[model samples]
Target: MTRQFTGCLLSRQWRDVAGGVAIDLWFATAEEPLCAHVTGEQSVFFLSADQWPQAEVLLAGERGFTSSEPGLRDFSRRPVRALYFPAHRQAREAARRLLEAGLEPLEADLNPADRYLMERFITGAATLEGTVERAGGHLVMRSPRLRPADYRPALRIASIDIETAMAGLELYSIAVHGTGPGGAEERRVFLRGPGTGQAEVQAFPTDREVLTAFLTWLAAFDPDVITGWNVINFDLRFLQRLADRLGVPLKLGRDGRPPHWRPLDDDGERHALQVTGRLVIDGPEWLRAAFYRFESFALDNVAKELLGEGKLLHGPERGEEIGRLFREDRERLVDYNLRDCELVSWILEKTGLIQFCLARSNLTGLAADRSGGSVAAFDFLYLPRLHRRGFVAPVAASTAPDAPGGFVLDSRPGLYRHVLVLDFKSLYPSIIRTFNIDPLGLVLAADPALPEGASVPGFRGVRFAREGHLLPDLIERLWAQRDAAKAADDAPLSQAIKIIMNAFYGVLGSPGCRFFDPRLATSITLRGHEILNRTRDRIEAAGHTVIYGDTDSVFVWIEEAEDDPAAEAVGRELERTLNAWWRETLAAEFSVESRLELEFETHYRRFLMPTVRGSEKGSKKRYAGLVADDNGDDRLVFKGLENVRSDWTRLARQVQEELYGRIFRDEPWQDWLRAEVAAVRAGERDDQLVYRKRLRRRLDDYQRNVPPHVQAARLAV
Candidate 1:
């Protein structure tokens, strides 16, 4: 029988087959999972027609051969001759050989599977038309023709948590809270033997039985997305190890395939699990990628912060306590396990993290489960469009660029009153919009045929064309969408858009990106330097004392202001005049309408740009201020201070906070300082004196200069 189906592309892979490359795709449909097999697709890349002769000799023994045509053209309008391969391996081999032979191969770095979908504009959603066949008692769509489809199905999600003892490599319990088909809620726990839990618990006779039961339950539930707090590194890894020890095949995939574990390249520090037809999302990683900030990312802490609830035990002995609960209070242990699952699910729902991931994937063609794909996302969105615009992206540069950092002015140190902070809204993105600083524009400006007045002049011998560029328009659209998202109070979507916009310059600067060029990134940043310095000058000339300036903000000191209202008025006036100055300046000089928007960000009633520890020089990025909140309550804000540094002990931070608070409030701080000193001398501050620092490297790797944390880690090990 033949049929048509639509679903989200859950997973995709390709392998070399007998005749050609076979594409294996897994889709999550509303009713059921669909396995599709596509055959006879060849792997391909492009090269210049002149370079084909050398390429043929380089790839002599390769099974795949080049295409019999020279059709595509590159950015320089050079003809991009076609090269095809029978399989992915041959394509990769040919690319390596061509590179070794000093031939430039365009778009050869893309994965075969990705090239297949992205070339056809297929992102996460897909549709298929195929003939049905029976394979090993399961239905398979044979030789399916796939296309990009708009799919927004309600996905089935599972919140999973597991408890185990690391010392013995023992599996204690596997708890899952998920929604089944038809929106039915399912909660179950597969525990090891000797557990007298409630009806939701299924006790297993052995370790192997526990793993088996968990897999069976997972298959039965068949969740589209599995979410957990560190599930990949901890829970799934434990399950895989347990299954290996018991010599049992842990079939966790949608179609009873064993979970494929790919250890991360970070020296086995992280792992990624590929479950066919499902997404495995880690809560902590996903939240971090979405720019979620918390004092602590621990499951209990995050749950308490977000949902007003936390783990069963909030004490420091959680690990020991979980094991204790398992031995003495099995019912309580089961409840705790199930509560964790519920909390993770609730967190995901409240944060709208999944929604943001889907939105980002749809926008950038990245996998929904992928994290930290800033460069990849930028390339995905820009490359296809660039190709259509007659540009083949340049290969990654071998060396890193020496781009100037953001402009930071020398702060006039000392505590002052009524300081107004005026900030340029989205400065780099605004600069791109106004000046048209873009990669393609750089190329266009260099063309001799272009008119002298057709481009805007940039710093360090850079110029951008007046028309037909990519980044400025892309940023403008994203900026508008972000504003809309902010107006609608959609924090996740707003944050995702903000991160993408902010990463454009960085991606261009990064040597890892294919379009990396010093000129492209330097133009944006150096233009920013000019804008900031000139804005400060304009503000200072407007009869206000410019105390300090950073990349996009200027701090103006107003004399004898009694309250926030007066300071705010001064800020608004400065913002208006500076924006007008920039508008007139850019229009008169470059004939480009300014998109620079100077926004009044803060009215600090009492502000302090602190000095270096023992010197009179003011700190670069550290400051503190007193401001009034929306409710008219006075609040103290600290930046780049010991109060915000995690490496500082709690006692030190507390001392700084109390000292600063007293000073800012005009209260006597000498007595408070004396009392703190007395407490420290009397050993009453011992608990707060423990310094906590993150160990960023392996203990063994710290050879020449071992920090205290490294020593501590070594001791612990």
Candidate 2:
């Protein structure tokens, strides 16, 4: 491995480690290693592999020993692909595991998807040995826990992409960046490949041989992670193939050897990868999983949305412009490639993806790419240990709602007799503010007035700000500001702030977020459930009702009946009265700023907060009713509906959304369904929607299973 960052273990430490990207082990029999007191990496080696068996147990508890394959003598001499399970077996097992865990798994795989998946499983399973040891289980392996924080090589890294000529025969440019904090230290740059009409950063080099020398020089910065858009699928593969044909070692060493990646299953899911020693963050895949929605997650679009500026190259212009720059102007081409890396890096800085992945793996024993639970890994190494300690996890909660659920009012489509919408312009943030909720703030805000550092009221077991709490305080400030904003109708500012505020919780919830703490998420959601239920009760006592709510908005009905001529006047008065009532009642009672202002969002003549679809019980996230939107269309939308969820297909979302919209408006649907289904059966609708999961990996590894969506993706290729 090229000189990489190790938090504490100096190159001179003369010790070996037990874990690697696929498998690594270091042996140091010293009773006390150096630098043990540090928070993370400093702690790993000093504690010694044998001494910190507790930590090792936590990790090993999740993975099992790979049964050695028979007739595979001279393992080191076998092809890298021949080592573990076959592609089809891995894919099938992945699907089975996901289904068992209640996560709807995507079918089949393509090149990138398969490679990334394999990488995911391989690296994922390797850790099971250590986790098994750390969790107070058996001594499956002796090594340091591959905690993400310790694994973070550098805050500043680079992403390289290339466009070549003559079918993988020539050189091209590369991009570099460092994503997280301490970004200033990182630089984005690229080198040019030989092509038509290009000037040299240095003198021109002929053949792929000279280009390899340049890559060696570029390798010095010692990047923490190197990423790309589709560099693995297209660029790296080409480079490797080119180098191999030339009889030279492609020693652009970051990881011990070439990185491993997997393609998606049939029906074209996505791609993912894992560099052995180095972290390889893929821009396209990470952005999609982060919920960045756009027509295309191309370099330009994502970069523009993330950074204020993107590559000068635009849609159609990218190819000709890049090719020309490579052939004609090498410097600009390098600059363009570098700029692309910067764009990706900047977005990642703002979005804590790497942090989340680490936190997630640490928390629930799930890989970011894991669609299925590591049941054997969990049961053998984890559950027993936790059970012994008087801790037992509840089964996965039913997604369906319970009786007397959140929704309690009846409504319809029309001009609201009087509708008051209570919106927490950023509910969680507002709550943070109103209640002064923050991780760090919890400690500061903790009342010396109260003894024993009591937990926040209405919160179950969450002590206020402690030595290391940031999100709580962040949520608090935003929450408070949102309350004040709602009181004054700062619509634009509120919306912007609200979007960011809501997003914070999401990022935090994601395992990919660095701040991923189940406690933090639990603190927010469980408390939210507590607070919301109480708020509803208060509203009901006042004779108004919470008709519907999703995350932040609370729909309400306030009676306002008057003589025909004064009907409009009465409606306005009722809205005003209810708004005032909510603000005062909540403030005097709960001390939470009631962001309950009536928004003239829509006039629902009729709305049904359905009983959980199959049961006559109250529903939580599902409902369907009529709304006369301002656009003059009466829409009957579904809430807590099963059809619009992630497991459902694009077809399902479309069918449900349209069906309800037409149903509420009392429009004809028979013809539409007939035509659509017929077209689908005739294979005419094949092109309508193709599931393209976002991942970063090569495009070849997908060979066997072929789902329709994956086939559609192949068409794009």
Candidate 3:
């Protein structure tokens, strides 16, 4: 009996069946997890109809059928026919064959699951219908017709941590901090041996028993999202090895399926994991994608930064301490393990990273667990609209030469007061909107019949149609949505929107994107260059000395600085004048409404624009400033200087901070410098003298002699 159910897509997989491809889509409904099986759907790709004679000869025995009639057309406007295969594997094999035979195959790179849902416009939330049955406490349906549905379900999450030997092969303990149905919090630590701790510790006699018990607990909790710090590369990988040693399955997935692991590279330094019915997101990766920054991504450091607390054992001997606790102090070990787990959970909640992930997925139609797919996100939002505008998606390739980047003006190095910084708000997006710069618009404007004044002229022989463009309108909508998100104080949604909007330029520039043309990227960036230069000119023409400019900001140095309020008034006036100038200028010149907005970003009382080392020429992208805090206390801020560099020693940073602060504040520093030198000579700065440098290349790869870190690694080895 056919039935219908509504839910959000949780996971998807596919396999070859007897008759056709079998697609398994798991959904998270309000009641329970539902498994929908859409069968009898063949994998498909498009080919030009003229190539059918050669294709049939090449794919004679393939388990598929070629359409008798043409269905679609390639970007070149050649009529294309569809080829349906019994399974995804056959379709991929046929595509490879066709490629080897030098025939163009369209839409062959799309995943079957993605193709199916995108064709139906069923992103994330959808309704599934047909042949319903009850299976394993969840509803199961077969051959379901999916329709778009607005299903947003609350997801259960678990933060997992594991303690292991220094070699990272032996399992010491596994701890889970989970929130399940009804928001009930669950905490458990499966220690390998008999122990006692403040945490809820379940002791087992052997590693195998502990592993089995942990798996059981995980199944019982059944979290939709499993997260940890470097969980896949370390903890989960070790657990899987342990399970294999004990001849047991690592059944962490909801449907009794084991976690699948694939090495991200041939070196096996990193790996990615996929759970059958859950999203296993690495906390640090997700946080970085959300633009979170810290001194280090180490759990202890992150926890300390975000939650004002570190691990139970935080010190130089942390690794040795863990082993010692495991031997003599089991309770401490359990506490440490459980604290790590809970810290991950706390960090996730504090940052609202999960919400950001969901918002990103909702906005881009990508899975929540996917990372750094700016190009894919652009395609998901752009391709369908392009097709609707009577254009097929082009193949991924760079069609034009490289383009110049944003304009960075040479700085006038000096220390000055009342320096105001003016910035263009979302400069590239605004330029795109103002100029109607788009791939389709570029094509339309290039028509021979298009009159000279019919389209807006751009840099490098590019012209954009006045109408029938999509990106400008698309970005306008996103811009408004971002404003709404900001108004609602939805940081996650706001950030997601901002990221997506910013990715448009990058997507157009990337050769991996199907829409990539140097013209499209060049238009945006060159337009930016022009705008920044013209704005700087206008500011200079307005009787202000523009000391520095970079990409989208201009630093105006006001002479004989008054007070902070006077400086702020000057900035506001400058901003208003520049905006008015842009509005009138664009209206007069291009006959276009200007979206250019210059915002008053910062007022640095004592700003320093340093020159290049050992040269009189000024630097670009490096500066320092002093600003007053809310309590009227002066704070020294550094950019691209030793004070902010990670590789610099603590002693160097401290000395710079002290020297710069004293100089900026007009305080005497000779006595202080002498005292610091004496302390250094007396070995009082021993701890601060150690240099922490990142080895960006492998030890063996550094054939051009060795750096300090490489030498240290050699000495350690």
Candidate 4:
């Protein structure tokens, strides 16, 4: 039987055998390989179908398993989801695809003999996933009508996370949250590990009574939802194992409830963490929704980015800090754990993730724990409503994408050119407001343009199209009231409206949301692309240059009629007056119902959008905007906060800024590159070069190809 998993691939440990490699995959559950045989020579990777090359793949066995694969690993030892690619050749291709997906690809180039042995099991692509008859003596093939993301989930949500000792020996804490902004307090409970009772906040005398007191408290807070970060793989497993060893019931959560806590059977056997409850919401899995590309989602790093505050404890001795919190200082631990709870709450609020979770639940008919796709969500919501005297949701028409290689344009700095860049802030939300696009309404009314709070039209057999679809009615009312609030200038009401509007888009786009309809999303984005392009053309036709645009922002270059100051002033004034005319003209012409704000962003006297160092893609979102003063002096700034990013050491920013600053100001450069290189080699300003890079994950994963920071982490560990 074929097994499937969603996970990250780690390093390959090569043994003395000719073709054997110990591959590690970080899986979401504790699963063994689909086939029991573990080949010595194998390639490993994470589970994602998008990265796999379906064409080059000769065997289904070798193609990386997406979640849709036939079998699932049991939820227990949730390590890297292990997959064995017997030979290195197939693994190499899989590795390349993984690299494209933004993972650090690992390859083990073993001897050729192992490569040959691994090829025996290679199974290529299926002959046809879907077939169509050919009228002209040819057969066309396609995959199944993939409602690419149709999984909507039920909203009985539980946000769970775990805290454990660094030694991986003891469970220090376990917290489960509810669907509300607060984790658990709303309708859930948090269970403290044995260490919680001795917390410094209350200053209990002995460690022995602390664990018992915490358990007693747990007996009171009975819960259905169990949550945590890798709680199944680590936290709950350790706690249950410890309880078994001590011959005690793992009386966990509120009300000292007794649900059998099993002991660890053997190596690779499923453990306590795998025990299922009503639902378990992994904080990390949910966090993946945000798409924040940062190294390691450590508690400290995540807290700082989302909450603006982290645990007061700092330094290389975090393990020691954990010990101190439990042993020497219970108060600090309470503060720390409570702060983590708050951060989780803040993240949920910022993303409206729980709302999506609930929305997904309502759409997919799946429980909260099941991750659903957009197509699944849409189908779930649309089909039942259709069945009650209804119709099927239109399956996405598979077609070629718009060809790449669209030309990128640039706007160079001209003499005193007063360029007015017009921007549409939150265009999608506005479009939703004007168009009456509500996902809930689509589910209920299924109408192209439903009015605000309009009763969903009654279905042939179903009722309440009259009352309105739940989500759409909710959104329509929210949008209408938001508009009212905005008009009335009620700050709090306006905020609520904005929240609901933003949440609509996220729900439409989110895979876990029930209304994850691509049509809903496409309707918004395609319109946006059209608006941006049309706006540019409108400006250009009016005798002004629309130099560049990205999404909602448009950059313009005011034609400099002359080089001298007197002539430049005349040109700038003309540019500003023309901008006002364009704004009014767009409003009068199209009933698109949108507003644009023009800002005089920069006075770049000289600029360069150099092609990316390795590729011909003219480096976009990377450029210099500079201006010169009367005394042959200049100052420069980078477009993308290039100066502050920690990876961009002091070297590049200073050199680029100085070079442009002088060039823009009519200052002649003589041998500038030489001086800059010498300065760097001499270590004249080395402190500026000392970069503190963040380690994104645990240090063990980097055992093979060690980055400088990874090496630093190893030393620290």
Each candidate: RMSD: 2.8, 16.0, 2.6, 19.2
> Residue by residue across 636-714, what tens digits does model 1's lDDT show?
9988998888788888888888888889889998987998899899999999998777777767789999988788778
Maximum-lDDT candidate: 3
Question: Higher-lDDT candidate among 3 and 4?
Answer: 3
Candidate 1 minimal-lDDT segment of 10 residues: 68-77
Give candidate 1 misplaced runs (Cα > 4 Å).
1-8, 24-37, 68-70, 75-77, 126-154, 180-184, 314-317, 713-717
Candidate 3 per-residue lDDT over residues 415-462, each given as its tens digit: 888899999998999999999998888877877788878799887788
What is candidate 2's lDDT per residue for 1-717, written digit by digit as tens?
111112311111111123312223211111111111111111000111222234233324223212222222110122111112233334345434534654332212222222322223222222211322221211223333322112212233555666565443666654455443345544433353344333323334454545464465445554445667765556666666677787666654342244444765654343444443344556666555445565457777666666667777785446667677777887777667666666666666656655443323322233432322333222222332322322222222223222121223333323233344454444555454444444333333344654443334425454553323344444455557666767877443344345455555454344533223454455566656655565556566756656665555556666553422343443455456656776787678665566444533444444455565476556665655565566766656555574435434577668777876666556899999898889889987675454545433344656786655556666776
**Cα miss at 429, model 4 (Å)?**
7.9
Error of 4 at 470 (Å): 14
Model 3 TM-score (2 dp)? 0.94
The TM-score of predicted model 2 comes to: 0.43
Q: Return whichever of 1 and 2 wins on TM-score.
A: 1
